[model samples]
Target: MTDTDNRRLLRQLFDAALAVAQPSQCLHHFLPPPVKGRTIVIGAGKASAAMAAALEAHWPDEDLSGLVVTRYGYAVPCKHIEIIEAAHPVPDEAGLVAAQRILSLVQGLTADDQVIMLISGGGSALLPLPADGVTLADKQAISHALLKSGATIKDINTVRRHLSAIKGGRLAAACYPAKVVNLLISDVPGDDPAAIASGPSLGDATTCKDALAIIDHFSIAVPPAAREGLASGRYESVKPDDKRLQNVTTHLVATPQRSLEAAANAARAHGVTPLILGDSIEGEAREVGKVMAGIARQVVTFQQPLPTPCVLLSGGETTVTVRGKGNGGRNVELLLAMAIDLAALPGVSALAADTDGVDGQSEIAGAIVTPDTLFRASRLGINALDYLSNNDGHGFFQALGDSVITGPTLTNVNDFRAILIR
Candidate 1:
């Protein structure tokens, strides 16, 4: 296939991955039945606003009134459910206030009512209601430290669940006997309901001890008040057996695996054999890139995995330690490292991006890599190795005019990666 053909196919695969996670596709089947008293919708995440819009669109036109907070550019208009904009991947004053209101909205609910929580990636950070002793500043500091330390999502959320006033089943606890229904869009490695957005509605199996242990493991500098809260068990999560969370029912409306399947189908449509490596692949971004490059070489040189005209698809969250000062997200970072390892291997091109359309903190989604990626970089007076060392994947791709910019897709399913060999 020509480079244009290859890039088009890669783009199709990405669009397919995104389509499966959109609210219109995956959310309709999971909408809960209407309740007697009222159907209160409260949520926080990149997709919560769109989830609300989906729910309202399919409802029976009954009493459906609530609030949901999403990333600043992710909010879509909703008729009954109010959509509020907040910061994501990091909490801000807007998110804090939105969380406070979410808590207040769920209060004084009855057993006859129902509270539906639209949870997805970034929810934990969006709903930053700090615990009794911990301030939002403390939580924000810890969040920054964990993100830069290359801590896994599980560990980051473990700490977040304990420190927050409304995470790790605390949100469900607040709506006791009100039948909390969590409609989650999974972006985590394993589609663990309790791990999605720190499982604001689902019961938690982890404890404050686990949170403290993760802090120590990551060498995170926990604020004094937050540390005190953990030590005193004041910020402990609601246990799985807790009666307050008994009435909560969680459902994964969409997941990384589903998104990967969509991409695979797209690949097959283009007469390309699709190999889904896994949906839960996780590790450091650059390391994963190198490993993926090795697999692509195996396919290109030996055809052990499959013959040519094949695409390798995988989805999961990868972390960047952020040692460099340049702008780069995990997706682009992974691609840069992979390109360096491949060293202009013929007929091997790949695209890696976050399905939510925002990789890391930047508006750029991800980037594409070709067999001549390094060659093209050199032509542009760019050194791929130095870019990788400086964590400048976005810069490198932007300079090459190969960065994939999708803006806000109004949904979240973590990262999507595809390596095409032809």
Candidate 2:
């Protein structure tokens, strides 16, 4: 097929996957039976606000009240539920205020009340209520360090849970005798309920020891308050089977695997063989890109896994080691590395994007790279290798006009990648 046709088909696959994970589409599946008690809604994430809007639409006449925090620009209009915009991947004053409000809202709940939490990716940072002795600045410092340190989402969240007052089941615990129902849109690699949104409404299987280990593993610099909090043991989060959590129920409404399957189905409809490489792939971004490049080469050169005209689709979160202070997201980094490695290989094209429509802190979702990506860069006096080495994939792709900017999808299922070999 022509390049235009291929691009259209690929976009269709992406849209189909995103459509399945839309808040309006997935919210109904996780809504519990009409509870006789008051419904207090609370949440944090890129999708939380949209989820709240969906809840408001579905339960128009229900006695619903609460708050949800989403990344700035991801907020949707809601009637009763308050939509608070906050910083993401790093906490800010807005997140602190919103988080405090959520904690206060659930403080006086009784057994007769029901709390609905809309948790999704990015919640860890959006619901930032640092534990006692740990200031918001302290959390922000650690969060910034963790983001730049190339820590896995699991590890980053492990530290975040231990550092926060509302995360790691603490939010649900605050609801005490109230029934807490957590509706989750998982973006973690393994789709572990506890890692999504820092498992604010679910049990935290990770410990302070794990948090400390991650800090040391990434060589992250911690503030005095963070160090004390991690050592104090007083900041420990709630665990599963804790008597206080018996009334809390967590549900995974959507996941990366489901989104990947939707994309695969779209590919098949376009007469392209879709080879799923699993949805939980992880590891360093550039390394993962190299490995995927090898797979694409095999598909094209020897047809080991599949023949020509096949698309390899995968979804999951990947880490990035920040070696340079350049504008880059994991998806863009992966695409850049893949482009350099492919080096103008014939008939190979790929797209890497965060399903949430924001890759890292950049405005662009991700990027699209053709086999000639490196060649085009070279022709424009742009050194692809240098860009990758500097962790400036956004700069490189922006120069090429290949960055995929979708504003805010307002849903998170982690990263989505497709490599098409023709």
* Winning model by TM-score: 1
lDDT per residue (tens digit) for residues 1-422 in model 1: 69999999999999999898999888889888887788899998898988998898898876889999998999899888888887778788889999999999989989999998899888988899999888888878888888888888999999999999899888899998898888999999989999998988877899889999999988999778888889888888888999888788878999989989999998888899999999989999999999999999999889968898899999888889888897659999999999999999999999999988988878899999999889988988999989999888999999999999999998888999999999
Task: Give the Cα lDDT of each candidate.
Answer: 0.90, 0.88
Candidate 2 has a TM-score of 0.98
Residue 286 shift from truth in candidate 1, angstroms? 1.0
For all predictions, the C-alpha RMSD in Å is 1.0, 1.1
Candidate with top lDDT is 1
lDDT of 2 by residue, 1-422 (tens): 77777676777888888999999998887787657778999999999989998888888475888999999999999989999999987789999999999999998878988999999998988888988888888888888888888888888889999988889989888998999998999898888998898888988888888898898888888877777777777668899878889998878888888998999888888788999998998988999999999999898889969887899999988888888878559999999888888878888989999999888888889988887788788899999888888999999999999988888997999899999888
- Clash pairs of candidate 2? none
